[model samples]
Target: MAYYISSFISPFGMILINILDGGEEPALKLTTEVLTGHVAVYHGDQIWRVEANPDWSLGETAQALSDLAFEAEIPEELRTLGIAALQNCVSDLYRRQPFVTA
Candidate 1:
């Protein structure tokens, strides 16, 4: 169970992605540019069978996780573990991209 988030930052904004490593689930993405942001969670392998536009908020990251829990009818504890795992992954990524101003 691993999480991967890669970011592409630009002068305008950034594109954040969440991709699975050892799973079959499609990746999740949050993109921003100027005044608008988009959140999408993909479903399916051969093709995208489902799509979602979760509320645009940083908290939506966790909210999306909870939503998945409900949708998949998984146990309460799995949501907790999943969110924690994602947080750790983000922290690791941030470490590699430490902030700097120019």
Candidate 2:
């Protein structure tokens, strides 16, 4: 089970945050779609587009999850669970991408 949090900085540098619960199949599906859309809008056809490795560290993932939890007004215990889930996902992703270090 995993969760994800995303923040997009606009062209003017304004930030919009979205928190996703990836544990559920439906949620995971939706998150992937949303993330894909985000990437397409933000990075597609841009000279700045760069395929950087996703190497989010545990601390960074935890912090992102915490912020998401707070924003979503989820219970503290559930938020902790979400953080753990995100950490596990990040670890797995890191392993899959051998070059990425977390």
Q: List, residue by residue over 20-100, the lDDT tens digit for candidate 2.
A: 555332221101112322211111122111221235443343344344444553445444554455455555555766664
What's model 1's TM-score?
A: 0.34
Global lDDT scores for all candidate models: 0.40, 0.36
Kindly list the per-residue Cα lDDT of model 1 for residues 1-102, writing each as its tens digit: 555544443322233344444555534433332243332333333211123333333334434533543454333444344445545544554566556221
Point out where model 2 deviates above 4 Å. Answer: 1-66
Error of 1 at 8 (Å): 14
Instruction: Report the number of the highest-lDDT candidate.
Output: 1
In model 1, the runs with Cα more than 4 Å from the true position are 1-73, 100-102
Error of 2 at 57 (Å): 11
Candidate 2 at 27: error in angstroms? 11
